[model samples]
Target: MTGQLTVTVGKSDGRVTVLTLSGELDRDETHLLEEAGEAALASGIQLLVLDLRSVTFCDSSGLRTFVHLHRLATARGACLRLAELHPPVSTVVEVVNLDRMLSLHPTVADALIL
Candidate 1:
């Protein structure tokens, strides 16, 4: 519970920043997620893709972070997307119907293609 969340970010095509998050995005880890997301947006990256394939659990905090990131991306003339979400994270996104506002892909490669 005290450990830091692992958020790995990489650049692609000089325009896309892929942030791969592994581990739970709970209260203990939300800050890290937000920081990573903000950093990507701050870098002037036009496309932000979050790879949550390794995330086994997500709560309201995680969902809120995504929403906040979406706004950040929009303000920066960029895009924020979620990819490879496991059932738990996917459920939160679906219940909130964010799928309508944001893009969700089955894989990172798919998101990049978008």
Candidate 2:
């Protein structure tokens, strides 16, 4: 299947920036995530949440992108967390032990609470 990724940015209470990602996340699409995250941080958003509920699949390169995004958030004194991970993506995260490395929540609401 051809790879696709969509990133939608929104905010809650003007503080938390939510980035909703859907479709397959792969090496070719990592730039989208980085660009969105950079835009959020550049706009002075301290709280960033990555909503992955709609993501159908994620490759190892996608995981690397997440790590880079996480670093970008931290470098600017911001927070980056994952929420509502798809089952297959969740399994990959678990298998790679990213569950322990990244802040993960079951839903966007839960992530907003962080």
Candidate 3:
């Protein structure tokens, strides 16, 4: 069975916005994230942080969504950061070397500050 994905808008301060995600991220759920990302960009956010601490699983589709968001943010002159990645998500990221291409932080606080 596939897990349900939930995307919640956490905090928004000035130009920064946080989207907290939980559950599995796969091909079927990528659209949820993409929609949220587009909305953040449209709102004129300077930084978009994804708090992924609760994300239990992530596959290649999830990785692709990350890259898509990164590109979208870049085109809009916004920054995209991932924070508190769970082990499974981290492993997929490392395997694909996405860690080098995307901004990753140990926590949302770190992602916000640096």
Best model per TM-score: 3
- For model 3, residues 1-114, the per-residue Cα lDDT tens digits are 278999999998769999999999998898899999889888999999999999998988889999999999999999999999969999989999999999999999999983
Better of 2 and 3 by TM-score: 3
Candidate 2 lDDT tens digits, 1-114: 348899998664456789999898888887898888888878877799999989988888889988988888899888999999978999999999998889999988998875
Hey, what RMSD does candidate 2 come out at?
A: 1.5
Per-model TM-score on C-alpha atoms: 0.91, 0.91, 0.96
Candidate-wise lDDT, in order = 0.86, 0.86, 0.92
- From the highest TM-score down, the ranking of the candidates is 3, 2, 1
| Predicted structure 1: lDDT | 0.86
Clashes found in each candidate (C-alpha, N, C closer than 3 A): 0, 0, 0
Off by over 4 Å in 3: none
- Strongest candidate by lDDT: 3
Residue 57 displacement (Å), model 2 = 0.7
Badly placed stretches (over 4 Å) of model 1 are 1-4
As for lDDT, the candidate ahead, 1 or 3, is 3
